[model samples]
Target: MRLIRWLVPVLIWLAGCLVVGRAADGAEVMLPEKFQRLLPLHEPLGKPGPFDWLAHHPEPGQTFGQYVASRPVVPDRRRRTIYVQPLGEFTEAQQRIVELAGRYLRIYFDLPAEVRPAMPLKLIPASARRRHPEWGMEQVLTGYVLEKILWPRLPRDAGAYLAFTPTDLWPGEGWNFVFGQASLRQRVGVWSIYRFGDPDRDDETFRLCLKRTIKTAAHETAHMFSMLHCIQFRCAMNGSNHLAESDRRPLWLCPHCLAKLCWATKADPEKRFRDLAAFCTEQGFDEEAEFFRKSLAAIQGRR
Candidate 1:
């Protein structure tokens, strides 16, 4: 099913109010000196357009201090690898995106990531499958996948286990479809590339599909570590209600969210930026590469 899209003009005004005044006040002071340098390079989220995620969700964004206080789930000596499990058959192009997403996740979180062998779609029994009421597309129940498929097969050393499927997903009834879904406490999530557009169409479309896949993968994985939707900046952790909103989000985290990830994974801020910069450059994502390089420069005091 095509994801829903619409615009709600007056709601844009409310997007301004999504950030808690206290969180904004404490944002900078909560992070280390290096992370604070990243503040000026990042922009606050633009006003949400009609039918935007922020306009409808209205989240009171989390701050670095808030995230730390939550005692979030973080990787330990025993379980630190992020595992990506393929749930069904994928086109050569689609498979390429999946593999790249695993590599991106490694740099994005500074975690060890592995792409496992594909699990046949037939593994998902008929009970968990349904044809969308109106859209007529075959959809899998996300809850079933998370609990039955992912949870059971979760590896002993996995910090987070994510199922990458080419199938459509619905969390349950009353919702049409979702781009992806994750379990905050379970450390298991499932996302689909089915709605991300066909990567085989062209070079530009392939890059677009790769970017979108990376965004959702990183965004949902952070949830398992207890990072909430970012309200303070235009960031990867920000809640995306649809493809348009997700596309508007950058591939990097805001300082506050970056601080959270760095702390959770014990990753060095400068090194993380440098790695992402190199990865983007290698992938032909010139704009994203420049942004990563600029962020690294900010932390290194070169800018």
Candidate 2:
């Protein structure tokens, strides 16, 4: 069962690689010079650590040109809004993280982000619920929530419909748990805050939880846009097999991935960096704020 769970993602990734290769024609559009300039700032992915995601599932990396040629999904005028749905209960601190995450998504994607009223966990039937045999913790079926619950409720104007839950999630019988799951074609996704730690514990913990939540929010949403897992750099879109690997990932997209986002959303690179920088500054993410500031400077030809 565990082997099957792992093989599914591997097979999907291999199939995507084939699609990307076949789609790579001379029709690939060139990214702007400003975006090209930032490429050097990012480091190419190195050897995977012992427990890294790459070690388990090697992925053929996608380039900016190939991404364009692949005809990846992008937001259209008809689907301009990004809707965030709250599932189940959340602590006061967790609720704050959700609100902040929504705000970050708005700035990140340059789209209108709305959080609908909370939906009760009671909506998940007993058949879809389980208690971990070893950990003894409650779990819910991620596939059930994503396909049955979120997909049906997806809004007409939603470029992406994301569900933020406070409970733990398992993809199916084999997997123990997953931080999140998404349907790239269906444009719907769900993520759990269960392993992000208690934000209410302390200021530091709150910030940590907020950061994790935001990263997952942005990363998963990118998937909805049909962006594949990044392998070019230490990017937000990089796949992570565990919490530590996820923690090691940057909170910002690298140049290649950024170009895809900019092209898809028609966002101005400089303005996008400035907006992200300002948000990070306001949220007391000094290091991240500094990085965005540098990115903005680079895009403006000042650095």
Candidate 3:
């Protein structure tokens, strides 16, 4: 009993000394400073919590001229082209990026034959990444600037943001949070390799995560069209969770946003949208294929 008393007092005194020192230094006493403390509180704070993307806009400004100057363009005006050009030695998940992005471009924004799609998704040699290690996770999405990638083929009247995510995302575990981006960029990219197969499945613990990517990629591209994320009505651009969240999202834009996109791209709503669906099915998205079909029908019915 005596030993316990002495030991307890000393321990208490030491703790008090540390606390006083910390207070003197103006250090916070956040409980989760240690993993053990945070273990019981597994849930992250805030809505759209974790795995969130671009909390803000880029400093240089997200514009066409600046975006075009970032990279060189290569012409491939064939009716439909999806290039998976390797930027550097990339992981299989990264290399598959083209087909992944192409999967959505084919559905959401498949430009006509005149508007070629030059997706910069490839597996370059290790030397390439070594040469430019500073490239971010979402780097090279627009490796080919807007004009360079779409000019001579399609009109230059839009912007594109590639929400590159590490291949290990799930519904919500708060992966890859470096902070400082605007809320507009939150949850930007959906669950790829973050989903199912694609080899990223082994590392990713959930199977449902696979399908989520399809919806996400398409969602981000929709933003490139000058359309704000959906606010009214259940829409494809409503922002999402699992594929269901995305599925709940309608394929077409809200009437307001749709009007804006139409004004920006000036695509003949019915023909261009229907044709885009045809292109997606050609690439293998029966689900989105059907979605786009209905989207075209919905707009056409209005006309």
Candidate 4:
């Protein structure tokens, strides 16, 4: 019994380390082709670069990158509440984000997700904004700080990948300058859609980044439950780096992949997931609403 306890922790820790390393490698999700000009694949904005959350799937029995997307999402006879604990300086932001994320989960993932009232996501603001001429006074987002915000949350090892994203990098009034970098192709690995939000503006990036942020939150959370990139199918799991790539990819997972999603999450495919169009409509994404609606019906009907 003594040996088992000691060994269990050690083994669990070792397992966690491997997953953390894989997350750090990042998944390479593709964005919609039309939005590619705005975002791009090499950047790894919404989807990861090419990294799996567990670095690999935890339960390899059912499938590789696909989780039964909605099966585990069934109504919780018991209350289901998730919380975030932020570390370092910006505790309030982290806590509030957890609440916002819950709102998003219930709406998009169709999960009755809840946020615990007392639990506050810890926040550390050492790397909050950056110093840039275009960004005005306190606007800093100098670089990708996932290592600061997220990676440290890991205890050496945990899941497959570490999804590190800032609020968002949607185009604003001065977006042309922010994204009009000459290094778009050469450094897709290092370069992302965000440089800094407009210096003179207020919270434009925060609001605009909502759509992409939800995509990322849902994607990363799926990783936590042992889901993989839907790349093999023309679905959201496809790796993308730019906005266009994200836009091009449909919100629905493919049938084979959906099967895996069904297995992992145990959600009813017919009921749990909101038809892509419905999801888009709820999100006020009128642009792709019709397209995703059609896609979801076609995909679900066939199966």
Best by lDDT: 2
Q: Give stretches of model 4 more than 4 Å off.
A: 1-100, 107-110, 115-208, 242-244, 299-303
Could you give candidate 1's per-residue lDDT for residues 127-197 as a string of tens digits?
88999989999999999999999998989999999999999988887988987888877799999899998
- For candidate 4, lDDT tens digit of each residue in 1-303? 999989999999888756643442222222222222222112221333444332334322223321222223322334222222222222343334445555665554444555433311134243444334564433323232334433344322222222222232212234422321111111111112233222124344443444554555555455445454553445555545556656565555554445444544445554544454565676566655765544445435431
Q: How would you order the candidates by lDDT, starting with the best?
A: 2, 1, 4, 3
| TM-score of model 1 vs. true structure | 0.88
Pairs in clash, predicted candidate 2: none
- Give every collision pair in model 1: 7-50, 8-50, 8-51
By TM-score, the candidates rank as 2, 1, 4, 3
Residue 87 in candidate 1, Cα distance off native in Å: 0.6
RMSD of each: 12.5, 11.6, 21.3, 15.1
lDDT of 3 by residue, 190-280 (tens): 2234233444445342222333444555555545443445433444555444433454454444444344334444445566567667755
Q: Give the CA lDDT, 0 to 100, for residue 275 in model 2.
A: 94
- Of candidate 4, the 10-residue stretch with the lowest lDDT total is 182-191
| TM-score for candidate 4, residues paired by index | 0.44
Better of 1 and 2 by TM-score: 2
